[model samples]
Target chain A: MAENQGVLVYLEHREGKLLPIALEGLGAGRRLADTLGQRLSCVAIGSNIAQLASQAIAAGADRVYLMDSPELADYQPDIYLALMGQLVAEARPQVIIMGHTDTGREIAPRLAFRFGTVAVTDCVELNIDNTSGRLLATKPVYGGNALAVFSTDTDPQVVTVRTKAMAPAVPNASRQGEVITPAYKVEPSVVRARIVRRVLAESAGVKLEDAAVVVAGGRGIGGAEGFKQLEDLARLLKGAIGASRPPCDSGWISDTAQVGLTGKIIAPELYIAVAISGSSQHMSGCSGARTIVAINKDREANIFRHARFGVVGDWKKVLPAFTAKVKELLAS
Target chain B: MNIIVCVKQVIDPEAPPSSFRIDPATNRAEMRGANPVIDPYGEYAVEAALRLKDAGGAKVTVISLGSNLLREVVKKPLAMGADELILLEDAAYDGGDSYSTALALAAAIKKIGQYDLILCGREASDTNAGQVGAGVAEILSLPCVTLAKRLEAGAGNLVVERVTSAGYDVVEVGLPAVITISNEIGEPRYPTVKGIMAAKKKEPLVWKPTDLGLDASRLGSAGRKVKLLRLYQPVYEGRCEFVEGQTPEEAGANLAIKLREAKVI
Candidate 1:
């Protein structure tokens, strides 16, 4: 539509490492491009991103567009929006796939509105409409209580896929692709907001994203001290610790550890939900786990509905015994 | 200084999963017994505005758009100390997507004619699209900040601790910008008895599409650019296998043993 040619994905990176969700975006773009018989391209914008270009190629990009500059180190919404805007004018892609990330959330809608279009965000699934050749995006609404499929008729349809919703493409070192360095022409003055300071929460031991097992708690944990017991179980399994919104809001745990639709979306090998009621929002995050186990006092707690194995008992009485038995099982 | 905070009334997000239901024909979520509430996320935005009002003599005006909105529900902002309440409630306002929603809100803001800052939730608990605030800013041609944990308003500029994927960034922008508040702002203050009494006596100002001078084509569902093809609830396979023993302590041990046997640990 409107002389648009191919599918373009926004390759987002942080701390010199490409975000996994960006690669997932590529996987989704590759499929749609292949179906439409159009080339799939990705744009990597940031400083010192030469290494990212090759990775993007391996991850299924037919062409990699780069906007590398020292000034592009940190994400300024206006600057990035302008850069992408210029690229859209030049490349004329039919679709733009981006992560539902901090940058994408700001840029997708703004970019769509700039081009007199609309962006369907936090999409869990995407496809091409057979008759109209329009992009169809399926996103979760009402905190995962419902799912809605949306479509737009405008060219260069924009969408931000939910983080970790799609599996990434298999990377091949031998895959051939071309790298193009586009002229970065956004004026520095366009950025009205300036970053004064940056602070990252200190995470201990295993990161939540990479953890094989996750030990999460809820309001039933009662206090910060209860998390210490959960921590013991997590440590024994070489896993990470997570919690429901209450623990995070109650100051029992850092906000980063909160698991829900709005919080971190994790899919671990084994997810042990202790003293958690397992609301739908919480289930949206960890439902993808291979095997879910629940330890809660209430027999009717919602967590049990999703758990593969469950025990109905107070965490205080059950966790210590559970920990001891696990300690002995591991030793043997 | 004048400030506007945009809020929404929606099906309670914290409603028990059992009561949640989807109307297949309408492709919408309805509750069998749950009542609607001010979006949990928007409460933080209201809290952000009230805090600004607490610090200075600024007047905080709250704007909400929807159909069949409850008075006691939408007026919660006033009960929490906002100075004014405006509602764009009409059947025509129903079935709109984020784009149309932002169009009407921006039009209403223009009609009000005076504002130094705009505030909204990072996302509504119901839609969770998180686009309306940014869309409003883009339409109004103003700088916007999304997912701000905390904010401090200065003389001509406001400093906000905006949430990023990695952590957080402190950003400073000129006044007359939009800020989308995150839950990290801390718990919103409950409406006091005095505040609730004050809210009951003060009637809110109501404005429909005609009131804002927007044509029918540019209002509500008619103005939507993105079309919803289908809305449905996902089915879950709940087949939990319970591992138990005679006693609670024994059940705990049995669970661990069961996991080890299944090679799950």
Candidate 2:
């Protein structure tokens, strides 16, 4: 079992397409593997992912393991866990990596616990300590107010990297790797939870998570109507509209648009925060953004402190004018 | 039916960023004038439990493991509709990471011995580590699900709507299972004046680690399986210039030009 020891990355895909975070995980795994002088391997579980296995090799894995089954067409925690547990028992990899998505966060710890270990979730940075030769995981704690570095004495360090933290691996079309189709079985009767339905939230235009430039509204926007201005601004900027917890809680926007500690963490190149007083919780999600511009009527608003540029005025007056300016600039 | 909800008291998530500082010496946060509150997601869990109670007859017992100061925050769930509160207040439980915290919580729940269901927040705001729910379930040998947006009771089972990456999944799990509720469950209800008055009469029973038939030595940092090596703040280093303009339109135009010049657009 120790013969396959190396770094194993969990590759997540949907609709036969590899996820962005999966590539990111591979990139991270490659770096860690190179540093540890071990080979980088990737594991994907689904009904049809052999094409994805080839993509993993191009994306930097030296080896790819595919667990194909009809039952895995959609994500069922029970089936997926059973498959992964069998793989880990047989492969005995030194390190395991996954993206800190909903699935990863839900499964990593339980998987680690089954092996009598613990997982470090939502890690922003990972490195091997030169002295101890241990994986050092750095993650945000206290709602992104502080960073804590963690190390475990246990073998097979399990970690879930946060989204947008690591650069995705560049595809090398000529790269080659081994594809092992591991034989695993999942019993349906053991799975107590069964998916009766899946309701997808309707997404309008650009998803907030993928938008490069985001125009976000807050409670100061007043109500749902105020978000229309932001929507107009977002359209003009060719970006997406985001919201603080207050606006989302107020029903002005869907919870999906919430950018905060409890919401989605985004790392767009530019962020335009409007009328949002920055609390630590809200700022945590946007802290990774490269540039921030804040517009708030209150001069003392906490958002201004984090913004790279600030405008103090009534947003009712500012938003429309700002939208017009953006329109003019784009048109010209 | 009876249920147990695990609540944690953490520094207010709404506190301004500048109010937090880390002591590198001890690898911990230095709270400055920031009041502690029940974890926001935990409130949602309590709300989920209370909704179930409203629908049927159920007794909800809220449990927390932290400093004695947590008494102020744990009472919140009681005011919101929990029947009783139990605080595992002792110095032995201080600075315990999620694994140890779950161990202590699981021990407490086993002692309670009447819960048909167990619920907790998706994660505590302060630690931001979401291992406790699964860890508790692992220790208790119960089925578990995370990030549940909605839950309803069924015949000998529970129906849960869990939020997945692409959508929500409708799931059914057997009774005596653990569920970690997400904020999508909806806003927690505020305590009415009468509920607040009722809470005053329901004093939380304090328990030590030994009271739950657990070893005090295996309760806090000593019991933690993971080691925190360091703690520090990420430097903001962002320098923002105030945009000058006579009218809001003028500032907007200037800001746009500045962004264009910086090649950020």
Candidate 3:
């Protein structure tokens, strides 16, 4: 079978609405496609989501493939894998891109297995090697202690880019593209696991992965009581409260709030580490933070090496003062 | 009823950070010491299955995919009263990621059929992929509940409290389901001395890919869809400014001044 030569970006959507990462993926796919001198294509699979095709074109896709079905409405793995597997088998794009979100995490690995190709996850950056024209993916490894570069000798390089790794494209109202609705068959056996209900996150403002600022606590926070102060500070800063693996392992905090290779990876404008010694596992999740502030009594703490600013003192003294100052500044 | 709990051996969580690394050429994590313990989450799954057996008298089988070193880890679970142990080990399985691992495990599970329930850790401490449980569930055509912090077996269904970012959700699924236990589940029990003594004489059934009817190509790196290219430590370019003053109050003032200067306050 002759394979599709263009770059294909998977457009992720929920409840019939496109996600921000989809646009980012399109922007990235378009750039790679332009470099390869091929057209940019996108695949959108969900029920009654034809309206999303226009958005993909507006972002830079030259062609859009739509796989609409009622079975896809809820992100059942069987239905999604079957539909996406069929699309990839037919389209055979030289490269496939997806967002490193919940959906991408679940589907990409399985799709890669079905296709017999590599799918790099949580890539922070993607570019085509000028010499080989192969996709070069860079991601953090060993909990964020290191950055790894990967490239494949095979065609159809599949990768999932981290959110905000690429900038969203400028909306071009005049841009147009061909929207092909592919016909697919949903195997009765494919719908094995069903999502009975989606539990929405409590905080409506921002998730730790998407937050601009992150304030994290560690064993130095004393105990469960310290999180109350941390929560107040996080709210005042309009940021999210994160924790080292210790607190989460100790059951003081939820695993979702854990900041490490095992937890949520976060890249923010500023990361404030309170009494965190900055283990490599914790560091992997926040290596992308532009500026890091460390407050610890141990002057030899490893976290100081990664911090843009450091305060060698007790957080008990530093946190209250820091919180008050931030409050005062916001008030002014 | 038959049950299989997939367990792995991992470095103790309290181990120092410098102890964890992978040999670049081999692409396998290097274990610094023999202090490896049963992955915390895996222990939870084992305990949950044991509890189920204690209540319903179902047969419990503990299955692990790793080297002979896993025998040490399996001993603890066996002492906890599991009936049988199966270890899937081979050189080809080395450097395999989550998908391939799941594929091999699914093949093993298929060979050992008539299982009423399968339990797995929500995520492994090493790869932290959190995909194998779901992947196995997909391949086996079984319903799965990921990140179940609390679980109970009912008359005809399984009742679970699944943890998510929002909070916990109460869910009910029929039997013959897969449930991945979270750390939020209670701590695993330690093996008793009597149980440990008995585990010493118990031999675990070892199998290779051929034994389980899995294609060799689908059991290792070749079966993996994700590959690690190169890994290097993150570079720290930021310089820290240490605030100094005579007293705590003065140091606080100096810190405030620095924050104001940066406009971060």
Residue B125 C-alpha lDDT in model 2: 88
- Taking the tens digit of each residue's C-alpha lDDT, what string does model 3 give over A1-332? 67559898999887666788898898889899999999899998878998888888889989989988776676665577678888888888888898876567657756765665547777778888899888888876544545677777656677888777788777787998999988788886755545566666465445887788888999888788898898888898789889987787677776678886656777888898998988876876776688788888887777887887778888888778878867776787
lDDT of 1 by residue, B92-186 (tens): 88888888898889999999989988999999988888888988888898888888888888989999998765578899988789889988888
Best by lDDT: 1
Model 1 off-target regions past 4 Å?
A14-17
Candidate 1 residues A212-317, lDDT tens each? 9999999999999999999999999999999988898788988889888777889999999999999888888898899999999988888888999999998898
* lDDT for A317 (candidate 1): 87
Write model 3 residue lDDT over B58-89, tens digit each, in one string: 89888888664557776778998888888888
Model 3 residue pairs with clashes: A94-A156, A118-B225, A119-B225, A143-A284, A144-A284, A146-B232
Scored against the native two-chain complex, candidate 2 gets a DockQ of 0.68
Instruction: Report the first chain's TM-score for all candidates.
Output: 0.95, 0.94, 0.91
Q: Determine which window of 10 residues in candidate 1 chain B has minimal summed lDDT.
A: B161-170
DockQ of candidates 1 onward, in order? 0.77, 0.68, 0.35
The CA lDDT of each predicted structure is: 0.89, 0.85, 0.77
Ranked by DockQ, the better of candidates 1 and 2 is: 1
Interface RMSD after interface superposition, each candidate:
1.3, 1.7, 3.4
lDDT of 2 by residue, B47-108 (tens): 99999999987999999888866555679988888899999899999988777898899999
